[model samples]
Target: MAGSLVDVALPLPVYSTFTYSVEGPVPPAGTRVLVPFRREERIGWIVGAGSGAGLTRVRPILDILEGEPSVPPELLELSGWIADYYLAPLGMVLRTSLPSALSDSSRDYLTLVGKADDVGTPRERKLLAALGQGGAPRRVRTLRKALAMGSIWPEIRALATQGRICHQTVPPRDPPVRTHRVVRVMNWLSDLNDRENMFRRASRQREAYEALESSGGSAELAHLLHQGGFSRSVIRGLEDKGVVVLEDVEVLRDPFREEIRAEPKKLVPTRDQAAVLAALGEMLQEPNPPPALLHGVTGSGKTLVYIELLKEVVHNRNQGAIVLVPEIALTPQTVSRFRAHFGDDVAVLHSALSEGERFDAWRQLREGKKRIAVGARSAVFAPIPRLGAIVVDEEHDGSYKQSEGPRYQARDVAIVRAARVGALCLLGSATPSLESWQNAQIGKFRLFSLLNRVGGGALPPV
Candidate 1:
C-alpha cells in the first residue's frame, strides 16, 4: 500500500531481488513482475510495498506480468523462511516456485550463419564449420569456453540477421523426432474378425485396443503405445494388415489434474485421534503453536486426523491449510484421502508435472481456488496465500529433504514457514525422524502421540 518504487525478491540464485521503479503504478504484494539486473532479465515477487522516497538509480519495471498475484503473502513469507533456514538466497528460493517460461531465461549461444563458408579467419571459419555440421545447437557460453572468447551476444545477433548462419539463444533440449507409429487398428478392428494371426495378434492387441476403446474414443498415441506395448513396427504391421490405426497426436496442452470426487464417509475418530485433534486445535488457536508432533504408527488415523483439523481450519477463515506429503503422496491411493475430505479444493503439485501442469497448479494457487495442495517437496511452496495451518504427513520421511539445487528439508522448511505467518505446524508420522523426536523430547517442540488406530483398527507393530 505504498508507491510505485519497491524492492522485489527474485527466485534466482543471485542472492537478492534488485530494486526496480514502476512507471505506471506500484504492484500489490504477491504480484509477479519483471526486473532487469544488468544484462539478464528476471521474474520476481513483490514481498513488500514501497514508499517511493529516495528510490534512485532504479530502472523502471519491465512489466507487471501476472494478472493476479501469482504467489500469496504467506507463500512469500515461506520463501523467506526457506532462504534463511536452508542458507539459500531469497531470490533462489522464489525461483524454485516459478516455471521456466515465466523466468524468460535464454542461454547465450554461438551460431553460424554466413555463406556457410565465410565464417571469417581460420578459427572463426572452423567454429562456423562446426555450426554448419549442425546436429544440435550449442550455447554461446559453451562455445566461448571452447573458443575462449568474450561476450558474443552482439556477434550472434548479427550472424542471425545476416543469414550467414544464424545464432540465437536457445533452451537446452534433446532433438525431437518427427516420425510416427501406428498404435491400433482403429477402423479395421470391427471388420477384420477372420484374418490370419488376427485372433492372436488382435489378442495381444486386446490390451491396447481396450485402452483405446476405454478412452471413450480418440486416445493419444503415447498413451496407446505405452498402454498397449505396440512398437513402431508392430503398429505398422497392424496398419499394413488393416487392423487398428494410428494418427498424428497433438501434445496435451493442459497439465492433467485428476478431477477427484471423494465423498467424505462418516468418520469415527479413535480416542487417540480425538485427543490429538483436540490438542492440535488448541495449539493452532494460540498466539503461536509449538510445532505439534503427531506420532502415530503406520496405519494409524493420521490422515483422518488431518481431515478433521482441515475442516475446522478452512471453515473459520478466508485462508486454508497445506497438506505436505512426500512425492509418493501423489499416488492414487493417498490422493484419494484428501480428495474424499476436501474434494475439488485439493491442488496437486509435484515434479512429475509437465511445465504446463506446474503452471496450471501455480495458477490455481494464485486464484485462491485451491485451498489444499498435496505435493512432494516443492509443494511446500504451494501458493496457498492465507495459509492458516500446515499438516506435514510422514514428517520424518527423508523424501522431504531435497538433495539438489536449493537443498532445503521440507519438514524443517515447513516449520520455519509456519512460524513466519503464525500458522500451526503439525508433523504426523508413525516413525518420527530422530531429529523431530529429539526436538520434541527436549521441549523444543510440543508433541502429541496418538497410540490408537482409528475405526477399531490395530496399530501396526513398529
Candidate 2:
C-alpha cells in the first residue's frame, strides 16, 4: 500500500490544494487521481508528490485515473501558473488545459427497470411516463426539461424504490473512453520448429497467426480482419487453439478526419521569407532561444516559414512541435499545410472533436507516434514530451485569451512552455499585439520582420 499523502487540485472554488492518502504506488505529479471530496467522489489532478508534512486525518486517494499520468510536469507547472495568475481554481485551469475527455462529472438519470404500474403516486406515474417516452436512459436534467417541476427527486426515488424505474448515476466520461481489440500470437509460436506441428487443417488460424506475426507480433483485431482480409472466425479459432491471444486495449478515437484527402503543398519562399527562416533556424541553436515575433503582412508566407522551421527542428532534433491557431476555424487551413509536410506524424486537437477523438489524438502525441500538434489555443497544453518548438499563428488575435474559466492567454503560455522545455517559441502575426510589439521594442523578444509580401505583391498605398 502507498503511504504519505499527495496534494491534489480540484476544479472547485477552493484556493488551496488538498492532501489525500493513497493505498497504492504514489501517483506522480500531473496524474489524475479519484478522491472522495465532501459527500461526493470527484476527479482531481496530482500536483505534488506524497508527503507526511501536514495534518494526519486526510482521506485516501480513491484511485489513479489511468495506468500512466497523462499530463506532463511542464504542463502541470504551467497550469499552476495559470491558476495563480488568473486567480482561478487549479482544477478549473486544468479543466481548460486538458482534453475535455479526461475530466469526469457525475450525472443522474432514470432507467426503466420494470413495470410502471407499481408506481403508485401521480408524480411517480408522470416520471415513469417520461422515462418510457425516451425508451432509453433519461438524464435527470433532460427529464426535468420535459416535466414541469423544479425538484423531481421525490417521485424519482419513490419509483426507484418501488422497482418500477431506477435512478442511476451516470459516471462522467467526457468523450467516453473506449478500447481496441487486438490479437497476439502465443509464446510457443516463437520457435520456428513448433509452427508446423502446432495445427493441422487450420488454415484460418494460420491466417490470423501470420497476420499477427507480420504486424510485429500484435495487431488491432479489426484492422487485421479488414486490412489483412481475415475474418473474426479466423482470429477466434486462433484464440481457441492457443495460437493467439485476444484482448481489448484502451485507445483514443480520432475525431478529425478528412472526407477528401488533403495533398501537401510546399511554397517557394521569397527572399524575405528565406531570411526569416534562416533567422529562426539560428535561434533554435542558441543555448536559450529567445521568443521571436515574426511581424509579417498578410500573405507574406509567414506560415511557410513556420512550416520550414518546424521541419528543421523535428526532423533534425527528433523533438515535437506545436502549432496553435487563434480559432477552430483556422485549424483546417493550418492542419492542411502541416499534414502535407508531416504526413500522419501530425495531430490536430480542437473543441469540435468528440471525447474519444480528442483522447486519441492526445494519446498519439504522448506515445511519440505524432510529433506535431496543431489546433486552437488549447493546443499549447498538448503533452509533447520533448517539445522542439511552438508556433502561435495570429498571435495578435484576442481569441488567444480564454475569456471564461481559467482566462489564460495562450501566447504567454506558449513562451513559458517553450522555455521550460528548451524549445523555440514563435509568435507570428500580420498585426502584432500591442504588448508583443512593445516587447519587441524593449528587446524582450527578438523581432523579425517581413517587409514585403511573397512574390513581390505590394499592399495598397494608404
Candidate 3:
C-alpha cells in the first residue's frame, strides 16, 4: 500500500508544491485540493501523492474539492521539465499551461443569470443598490473609492460566503475541475501476502503492478496502461491499495478538434506526387523515423498529397493526422481548400475565434468532437489521440515561430509533438527554409523533390 499523504503544486505566483494529508480519502494526484493556505481557504492544483509529514507540524487540506483535477500529471511533469529547462518558475509554467481564467477567481456585480433583481447581501446590497440607483456594476476599485469599504475582497468574501450576490468568480467560466469517476486498486500494504501476490500475478497484471511500482506511487491511468491497456477494475484495486489515485487537474483539449473522424479525400496525385508519396509513406513506416521534408514547389499539389495521406491514415481508423499552415495561410482561400474536401470534419483554430469560441473549439478537439485540426502555431497541441501524421505546409515559413509567452517555435515543436505522439510529418515548401534544406541534405529527413506543374497552361508563347 502507498502512503496516505501527498504534495500538490498549485499553479500560482509561488514555485513550490504544498504538502497535505489524504489519509481518510485517497484523492488522485491531479485533484484540486482546497487547502488552508495562509489564513484563507484557496484552491491549489495537485501534483502527486506523498506521505504527509507527521514528524513536523502541518495543516490538513480543507477539503478535496468536488470535480476531477483539470491538469494531467504527464502534462504537469512535462511542463515542469520545460520550466526547469528554460529556467522559468514552475508556477509560471503552470500559468501558461492553464487557461487565462484560473488565475483570477474574483467576481463582480452584474445582471444575475436568468434574473435581474439584486440578489446580493447588505454590503453587497449597498453596492448593488448604489449601482442600481446610479447605473450598473461598478469596478470594485471605483466602488472602494466611492463606498469607502476599505478593501472589498473581505466584504466580497463575506458576501460571497452567503451566496446573496454574485462576485466576479460567481462560477469559474473555464472551470479547472473536470469530474472524473476513477477506481483504484487497493492492497493490504500491511499484509505480507499482498507483496507475494504482486510478484506472482499474471503477466498483464504483473506488468501493470510493476509499472505502477516504477511510478513511485501515483500514475495516471491512461499513461500507465498505454502499453497493455489495464482494466478500470485494476485501477480500482490499486486505489484500494491507496496507490493508484485519480484527480482532475485542468483538462486541456486540442483547441481545434471537436470530434474524431476520418475526413479522407481522394488525391489526384501527379506522377511525381505518386512516387514521392509512396516513398515517404515507406519512410514513415520505419522505426524511429525522422520528419520528412516534402519540397513540393509552389502550386505543386502539396495539398492534394496531404489529402491522400490523411485519407490513408483515417482509412486505417487507428490513427489521425494534423495539418499545420502559416497563420496567414488560414485566409478564406487557404482554409476553403481543406474544408471543401473534408467538410465539417475539419476544425480550424486561429486568432479569429473569440475567447469563448476558441475555448469551445479547443473543447471540441479535447472532447473528440472533431478529429482533424488545422490552424496556426498553437494548433500543434491538438488533442487528437493516436495521432498518425502531421503535415506542415510551407515548413520554411518564418511565421511558424512564436515569439512571446511560451516562446516556442511551431515547426520545431510540431516535430517534438509528433515524435511524442508517434505521428508522421510532411514538411512542404516551395522555398524551403535553410535549416530544413540542411536537414534534408544530411539525410535527417526523407526529401521529395517536385519539379514542374502538372500540365502547361499557356505553352509559354511557343
Candidate 4:
C-alpha cells in the first residue's frame, strides 16, 4: 500500500501493537520507526499494515530509522514463537534479538528556553542554575547528581510546562567501520615471467612481488613488507608502474587482539568417535533432520569432534556453523580454538566484548565475511547465512537459560533456529539434560555417545 496504516510495537510493558499512519512510502514490517507517543518520541518496530478503517485520528510515523528492515524475517518468526511459548513480552523478545549497541538508547536532556533566574521551586531553580552554567543541554541524570535530588522528573516536568526549558533525546552513537591497507598483484602481470625484465632492474621490487605471489597474490602491506624484507620505496615504485595495487579494506576489530594465535591441532578419532561422527554426518545430509544429543563423559574428547565437524561444514560445504558455550568466561578459550582452526573465518560474539567489537563481529557474520560464530548463549542468534550446523557445547548447563527479560532457553532456540535454516542441531554435554535425554529416548533426536578420553589416560581406580 502506498499510504496505509501500520501496526507497531514499542519496547514497553504493553501487550498490543499500536496503529500509526504512513504518509508516502511504507517501510517493511521489521523496520524501526520513530513515532510521537504521550508527548514524547519513542522507537518502535513496524509489525504490519492495513487500512485505517475504524480510526478517527491517526498520527503519522515521524521517521523511518533504517532503509532496510533491521530485523530479519526469521528473527521476527522466532520472536513470535518465544513470546507465545514463554509468555514473554513481544517487544522485549524482539529487542533481545538485536545487538545491545544498536539499541534505541536515547537520554533526555534539558535546554533553557529563557532566563532561569525565576524558576518554580527552590530545588527547581538550583537545577536550572546548573543547566544554565553548562551553556548546553544537560542530561537528566547529570542534573540529578549535580543537584543531589532523588527524583527530578516532577521538577523537570514543571519547568517544561512553564515554557522555560526544552527537552530533546540524544540518539545512541554507532561505532565506525575499521579499515586497513592491503596490496595485491596487478592482473596484467599474469605470471613471474612477465616481471623478469623489471626484476633485473629492481631486485627489491621483484622480491616483494614474489612474496605476494607466494602468499596467494595478496596480503596486508605491512605483512608483505615484513615477509619480503623490502622498503616502502620498492612498494611505491611497483605501484607507480601499475604492477601492483594498494587499497584500504575494512576489517573487523578483534577483541582478543593481544592473544597469540594458536595452531589447529590434528587428531585421529577413536573407533567410537568415528562411528558417531559418521552417523551425525548422515543426519546433516538429510533434508529435515532431527536434532542430535551428544552424550559423553567428562574426559571424552567431544570438543575435538565438534572442531572436525565444523571444519567439514565450513571448508567443504562452504556453509556457516554456530558454536554456543555456556558461560562468557569460557568464550576466550573456545574462541581461540575456533580461530586456530578457522582463522579469519571465525567471529566471536559475547557480552564481554566491547560494543564496537561485538558490532563488528556481528556485521562480519551477517555479511558472509565470516563462516563460523562462537560464543556464549547470545551466539545462538548470530546472523549466519546458509547455516549448516549448530553446536551447543555444555547443553545441560543452566547458564544457557536467559534468566531476565525474554527468559528464553538458548539451547532450545538453537534447535528451532537450525530447523528454520535447514541445518543440523548438535547438543553436546557430559551429563545430558533430562529434556534432551528424553528427546533422544523418544526418537525426536538422534543419540551419540563418546565413551573414553584420548591418549589412553586411564581413569583413577575407584
Which model scores highest in lDDT? 4
lDDT of 4 by residue, 1-462 (tens): 336799887877777778898888878888888887765677788888755777778888888888877777777787888888888877777777777665554578999887669637798888788888858888887778878888888887888887888977776444456788999888556655776876778888877887888888888988766765678999999899888899999877887667778987787888888888889888878988889999988678898889889978898889999998878446466678888888888888877777778888888888899989888888887888789999999999999999987788999999998898789999999889998999999999989998787776777775
Error of 3 at 462 (Å): 21
lDDT of 1 by residue, 307-376 (tens): 8899888876656788888886669677777778777677777777767666666666657778887888
Where model 2 places Cα greater than 4 Å from the true spot, the runs are: 1-3, 49-56, 106-252, 255-263, 328-331
After TM-score superposition, the amount by which residue 232's alpha carbon in candidate 3 deviates from its true location, in angstroms, is 47
Worst 10 residues of 3 by lDDT: 107-116
**Sort by lDDT, best first: what order?**
4, 2, 1, 3
Ranking by TM-score: 4, 2, 1, 3
Candidate 1 residue spans exceeding 4 A from truth: 1-12, 16-22, 28-31, 35-40, 45-61, 106-114, 130-151, 157-262, 316-318, 442-444, 454-462
> In candidate 2, how many Å is residue 176 off?
4.6
- Minimal lDDT window, size 10, model 4: 169-178
* Per-residue lDDT over 194-291 for candidate 2, one digit per residue giving the tens place of the 0 to 100 score: 77666567776766687677778898887887888987788777777777788889865655454445776746788888888888888889877989
TM-score of predicted structure 3 = 0.61
TM-score of each: 0.68, 0.78, 0.61, 0.79
Considering lDDT, which of the candidate structures 3 and 4 is the better prediction for this target? 4
Locate the minimum summed-lDDT window of 10 residues in model 2.
252-261
lDDT of 4: 0.82
